[model samples]
Target: MSITPTPRILVLGASGLIGRFVTDDLRQRGCDVVGVARRFSGGQRVSPDDLELPVMAMEASALAELIRARDIGVIVNCLGVLQDGPGSDTGAVHRDFVVRLLSAIRQSRRDVRLIHISIPGNETHDRTAFSTTKREAERLIAASGNPHAILRPGFVIAPSAYGGSAMIRALAALPFELPEKERARPLQPVAVEDIATTIAWLAARPLDDETTKAVTWDIMQPEPVTLGDVIDRFRVAFGTAPQPRITLPKLLLDAGALAGDLISRLGWMSPMRSTAVAELRRGVSGDPQGWISATGIVPKRMSEVVGARGASIQDKWFARLYLVKALMIASLVLFWLVSGFIALVISFPATTAILTSRGWPEAFAVPFAAITSMMDMSIGVLIAFRCTAATGLVAGILLSVGYMAGCAILTPDLWREPLGALVKTGPAIVLMLVALLTLDNR
Candidate 1:
């Protein structure tokens, strides 16, 4: 009796929300899984132990070499980028990277099966950057002559939040009324675990001649629900009271998108971008019968999954704390920027007078005030970014302590003011610490 060899699989973007789940699921099923990413940081949402394979660089040559060395039989590309960031191009990730990877695979002469996770609307005439790039990549894969299964999923609901999922959870948790336009937007939320399981199942199946002809499947839940309905379901799951809906003018949404675009230019991820809003306007959903027929796995309803998961106290805490963390970070940014602006432009005379009153020379006072203001603004900018937030928090703590001590010795009376200017540092320091604790590379 001869034993069939286990298929060696390589999973790209293994640190992301869906990738992490897919990698972990495949590993648990006793498959040899190799996970690759741009970088492997300890601070990713997924714990280090969950990743079976040590994360490697996403370079084409390196990845190809690894595949050859491992004798990989399947390639599951969980890689995707929702928005572009510094040094990370959306077009490159969605289209160019895949092209290079396919070329590398062909050079290796390995008849590896390709499983790609894509979004819906890519097949239509949608001209959005996200949809267009995805469609281009799909076209490249189809023409590559590799055995591929392209799965287009709707809104993937995971326990952890990022990008649009995070935005949905945050908005749902709001105690006030929500925009009516958002309430009417339709969505078919699919569980991340189900998607992961589906990918793992596909990886295990043999690639027959007929199956190798580049098939596409729309993977989503059978039941379709509106955006507002999902929000209410999440609120109930999180042990929160559902708020009433308020119909706001479309102009407000446009203005919000404009603000979101401005923020995106500053290298921050904003969910209210015009493109994102347009995607929401055009519902996210698809037929699930094809996926079911192929995999024989029926996706669970959104409400049932959330209800079961939300029974845990920890889940509720996470749901609530996610928004709290955002608010805390926002507060720190506002405080530091406002304080810096006042010192640099509005309160320069008052600042100089105070410094000179403490027996400091006029020349030193002017330069010191200017330098301090700049430093304050720098801290605000640093804290606003994910990569530099930790450093910013540390700088903020040191500066806060130094300023408090200096104020005590130089201008002790300010501590007793009605507004408690010096006393406010107590809360500010605590807020910075909270923000630091919640910082992640995502």
Candidate 2:
């Protein structure tokens, strides 16, 4: 397996939570690791050695060329989406991508070992599109006749959190109790380190090792754990004292999922999507004996994995503000949209009258108010989309500042207005700054 002296290890979706950790762990172990992601920048902890490519968009031939050119001996595919939405298609990411990947592996004519990360569930239990498509990918990989190992990890707890893990952390930090049904649901957890270790172990296996090749195994702790058990562990880790907790009704959870779905269409990958709730309801559990027998690695329990040490200040801040961040962004979007709509549509004449009062001609003031109102709405639109949210926040902040300054110079009397309308821009500006600062998803 190590014929090339320094064989290359390519990790797809390298910017992701699990992908980032796996890529770093492999490189630290002296493996020639090349990471790939849709978009990577220095701020995102992307190594200069990593390649920035939209891997999901690549065809079989393109993938084959890259695999051959890089002399990639192993590929760890960590690319996946929680649900189908804007810029995320479960079938495309899980099923179609795997088909192309298998074809590319054959065309490359290299002894590439595919270490695919998948969910832990059987076909009958695969109700959501995310689980269904993932199972389909597993089937394709098993039938492809490639040197491969499918690792179905259960409730992965990683240091770098996102999606469901982040939501769990938020819930743990907050002083609230989950419903009895959710609390009692089985949730077999596994540390991200164990998954990486399993992959590294498989990568070093001999080509003729029948046990490790073309095998699908569930990689998780053997001991049974529940959802409430995980949250309590996290609360202990955060050093939060026990208090009277209000249990939320199932109806509220359903509403949150619907809202999450709406936000996902705007390109924001909220973990509260209906599919996430569906999968959570199904619970996470599997037989890990096969993985244990093959790798001889004991999986770490939840306590050992997440609650080994007290939470740091940064960790506490992240856990507390995770869900609040979404709320703050949503509020800002609505604030801008409503403010613009009020000025343009609801009170168009009044909007221009204020300008005219400052010795501005009626004709010029009318169009000026109209254009500025449209600009405000445009900023809201920008902030609503994930890719341009930062730009929109910045624009909103600058425009707010401009408005404050312009009003101060031209219409100082407005500052003395009873409603304090001009002064309200200050708080809006501050909110936009906060949103811009906390915008990074990683």
Candidate 3:
């Protein structure tokens, strides 16, 4: 009896939500998986504390050489960007990267099978960057002579949410009624595990068959559910009562999209951008016959999928606490920035008066106030970034302790204020500590 050798598979975007699962799935099937990403730090090849696959962390220019050196037989392209944010170019990622990758594969002269993950609908007229670029990439893959399989999945639901999935989870967790227009859109949410399993299955399948090449499959759930119905199901899973349905006018949604675009321009990845809104409004349901026929795995209904993976107490708390963390960080940032502005610009008189009342010299007070304001602003900026969060937390703790000590020596009576503003510092310090501990090492 002859034993088939394990195929060497290269998974792009291995750190991503879908990529991680796919990498794990392939590895579990005893395939030799090499995960590739645009960037990896501290001599890290694979994702820290996630997967054990060997990884190549380099630029696109080095991809061909790496593939040839590693003898990768199958390339699973899971790389995708849903939104244009800081350092994220949607067109470049979706279109340019795929073009470069395909060219490299051809140039390397390796018989590599390409499995590309894409969206279902190919609306040529769609102005959304996501749809336009994805379609372009698909066209490139089809044109490339290399054997390839394109899987267009609808709404992919995972254990955790990120990007549009995160927004969907957030909306479902909301206590208020959803906008009527959004409720009308239909979606067939597919489980991430199912998608991963399918990818693994495809990778192991023989690619010598000519008919399977350049084929595209619309991967989705068996039944389509309204957007509103999906949210209601999530609400039930999260142990929340279904809120009353309300229709939001098109005008309001449009206005919100406009505002969201402005926010995105400021570098915040807002889900309400016009492109995202348009995509959501267009709906996400696709024929699943191809997927079922290809893999012989019937996709589960959204209800069954959600029910099996129902939100636990920990999940609910995490969902709610995520919002609380955001609000707390925002509040802290605002408080520090505003306080700095008051001391540095608006209320210098009051600040000087307070310092003078404490018997500080005029020369010392001015520089002292300026330095304090700058330090406050610095702390706020530091806390805003994940990389500098630990530093910021430590600085914040020291600063808070110093301030409390100074207040005890000087304005001790301020602690007795009815607002309990001074008392709140203890909780604020604790919150910062909590955030620091939970910070992502990525």
Candidate 4:
């Protein structure tokens, strides 16, 4: 079958995972693509060579000028950074550059489709100064009266030309402590391709169709996992049994996070800051179903991007996988003990729901909760004693996975979307992992 003619699309931040995926997807779809970056190799309009450059040069001031000069039809602004530091640049791109570009687009005869990728978080996604700036940019886009879409992508994990992910994998080869929140808190890790497809769906969306109208959409991993689940996956991927470690009382790290944000405000940016600690712990995120309903693209499984991290979970033995699982569960029990009963009461159902959905009935609905609920205050005492951690974790994982497997065997894949695996169901699994891992860690 013949393909439809693709539009002329321009991507800023062309070196980023989202940007790169957007670049490749657009090119594959036959869109005429012009990439922009501050220090693009050979300093040319086209992508550079074998080393696989991130199109660095597009950060240049002349980038918008290039877009207008080239008569670009669509602009995807994947331009953003986590902090206010030197390398963590986004003020201009998010605030000034976008305003300037949209204004310029307004002056032109051809209507431009503007897609801005933003996240709603400050230090760790709770809407800090960094997040505020993005909100400002989004407001400007909406007020500009241009055809635009605001895409707020959740945590993105993709392969990079840079060595950050590799370093983590290398570190995993040795015994090291994973982050505290990583052990317990829920995570919404997303595949890069998923983000790309969502953007493309918006970018190439027909202007006349209400479905394509530019609006704000949250792009998230269909399923979220806990730090423990991710670490277990990490261990599996790297083929290691390294003991993970971490500290509690997360606020101790806040000062560093705040400082990092200040630093990122001025420089290239470091991904590790106290803010992430906060996010991991909180597991704050919105549902992506609205976007999926409107745009028709769901995120790829977190496992797909495991390749980007160079970590494979498919090979690890259950024992190795279960250790982090143990630690993670212990951690959650600690958090609940620390947070007290209200938190525990609210958290347990969702946590158990994760187990139940999989195939583990005791883990899921009745007898387990009934048994736990029936236990007196002394039961909490027994849980805190530590002797029960291993048995609890083992029983939980088996019941959960077993039930999930049984259903998968009996049901169709379509019916399995929300029940199959942590990676299968969407963000809930990530939360379940967090609750369980922390309880194990405790």
Candidate 5:
């Protein structure tokens, strides 16, 4: 299927992770692409010097305006969300959004073709927040009686999203040690480009064919890989240490689910509910036979995409590996710097007080005097916070405490109380925290 260079296109949610790439793909392919976003249109206004594309930065109401104004032939509802944010509800994300967008499209004179990207198992209770809401949106689309193509994509785990976030990147880096029972279930992971390619291919197909086409397609890499196996490959690909992957029993999982809910309420990342836990544990068995028999679009495996580039996003995993290494190094450097600051803050002031009170500058005092004594005992208040919060608070403490300790060491007998100082240490505290909140540290 070949599309002309200038098929007037309108892409909603163009600023998002996938939408940005999809728009870039269409524009590069010579499709007259216009991005509809909340911000200014993304690329250069379609010009000789610039890729000169038009991006409409407007709310949904404004998008309705673009539909009427541009005579847009196709409307790609690329809007979706993940991660933590004020407006990140998956239910409202699509349920309301799809209802509004579809209505607008139907009302428009342009026989607008719609390409909606959906994740697989969207209707399953075991499905995560994204899957559940997206599933609902799909049902609404079917009822819309409008021409539409719904694509159920697998784990995109792109470098951009995966690299910037903690959980996804950590998942890719760590090797799984799942219990034998848990490992029985399977997951067929796909690369990010597979998504871009899927869209490009679908974009080229006639809307008539696409509309009467399959309601859902299993979009993934040709070869299916298990969750545990990918971790091993990730170790070799990134040259990182094997991570601990433990599978908890129902009893432990139930306890964790409760804890996760409580923490999320306090604005901490919560663990999955029992339903979600079951979905992850069970996953999907066998190849999604229905998906393949429908679209006939085979996805590229991670192995194929290791060095491949898609639209605007690079095989950023390669670069992302570097990013991870850099961040780890940077975090270590900040840790030490803060430790030094802590010593300055606590030790220096306490030493001065001791010296004035004792009227003694013990010659060997610096090494003998400990700085931890000068640290305010109150810093431990951070222990009550969730993992992310705890790390930030503890990081601040290390810097402040280390500075105090360093200063106090200069004059030992007066400021340093070895017995009192022995209780608090920057390194020891950080390590203890790393052990306590395994989710937050990485």
Candidate 6:
């Protein structure tokens, strides 16, 4: 008896919300799956089975070698960025990477089936750089003359939350509603499971299966839903009573988007970026009949996906703290930045006088205060940036401890000062620890 070989599937960006689910689902179905992601760091735990590679920077030849070496039969590209920032480029990630992947497939002389995940919109509706680059990628993939399937999923809802889903959950947990205009926009959602199943179905088909090849289908539930409906479903899952919700103003939402953009440059992928706001305004909608008929996937609706059993304690905690986390980080940044700036720039003489009056040598006290203030400022700067936030938090905790210890020995009277300046460091340190603990987006 001959055994049919299970094709090896390569999932790019396997650490992402959708990619991780797809990778796990495919492996469960008995297919050999190789998950590749650009280094997984911080709290976003890396799977021992997944490979860490800067795939976006890899050349076509290098990608070809990886494909051939892994004996990969299908490539699922789930890699994407919400906006352009320090380490993320919309054009490079969406279009340039796909171009090289297609080239690599051809170079390997393998019949690799490319499954490209894209946004739900055509050129006319492509407003932001994110959408423009995504549309270009689709065009490139279709014209590549390779066997491929483009799956454009709408407002994807997965068990694990990140980006827009995280924002929605946060909103639902709050005692507020988006303005009626914003709430009424279409937000047709599809379960991440359906997307994984679609990929698996295509993978299981024969190479000559013409139906799955070169097709671009929007994979979503047949019936459309409003943003308000999705939020209400989450509210139901959370067991929250329907009360008069304080509607958020448009001006506030726009300002939040501006703040989100600033945060993005610091390395954090905030879901409230201008691009996300614009997309939210435009709403998500696409014809799912073609994908339904092709893959026979009955996508789960928002209610089914959120579940009727109600949210777990962990879910409630996460939803409530989602926005708080941002505030905590911001406060910490300002606490350090402003304090340091004042000490180093505005109150340099007063800052130096503290140590000097404590019976310290003038020469030693001057440099000591200056250096420490600069260190404080550095910690604040580090915490402000997403990439270095962890290091900054750690440094902050340690330096804070050092300051308290040093103060107790050198200037014990300062602790009992009316302002309780030294005493407050304890809570600040605790906040830093909390920020570090909750930093992971995945």
What local distance difference test score does each model get?
0.76, 0.89, 0.75, 0.56, 0.55, 0.90
Q: What are the candidates' C-alpha RMSDs?
A: 3.1, 1.9, 3.5, 22.1, 8.6, 1.9
For every model shown, the clashing-pair count is 0, 0, 2, 69, 31, 0
* CA shift of 321, model 1, Å: 4.5
Error of 6 at 29 (Å): 1.3
lDDT tens string, model 6, 1-442? Answer: 9655657899999989999889888888888899988866454444556898989889999999999999989999999998898888999999999889999999998889999999996579889999999999999999997889998999999888998999999999989889999999998999999999999888877778777778999988879799999999999888774756788999999999999999888888899999999999999998999988877778887778875678999999999999999999999999899999999999999998988888999999999988999999999999999879999999999999999999999999999999999999999999999999998887
67-155: candidate 5 lDDT, tens digit per residue: 88876777777777543334346666667778777767766656666778776653544346656677788888888777777876655
Cα deviation of 386, candidate 2, in Å: 1.5
- In Å, residue 414's CA in model 6 sits off its true spot by 1.4
Taking the tens digit of each residue's C-alpha lDDT, what string does model 3 give over 417-441? 7998788888878877777664442
**Which should have the higher TM-score, number 4 or number 6?**
6
Candidate 4 to truth, TM? 0.58
lDDT of 1 by residue, 335-360 (tens): 88889989999999998998898788
Q: TM-score for each prediction?
A: 0.89, 0.96, 0.88, 0.58, 0.61, 0.95
Candidate 3, residue 207: the lDDT equals 67
Summarize candidate 2's per-residue lDDT along 99-164 as a digit string, tens digits.
Answer: 999999999999999999999966798899999999999999998889899999999899878889
The count of backbone overlaps in candidate 4 is 69
Q: Show model 4 residue runs off by greater than 4 Å.
A: 1-4, 41-65, 87-90, 120-125, 161-174, 179-182, 241-268, 274-284, 307-442
Q: TM-score winner between 2 and 6, please give it.
A: 2
Full-model lDDT, candidate 1: 0.76
Candidate 5 global TM-score: 0.61
Comparing 2 with 3 on lDDT, the higher-scoring candidate is 2
- Model 3 misplaced regions, further than 4 Å: 1-3, 39-61, 242-272, 383-394, 410-420, 434-442
Best by TM-score: 2
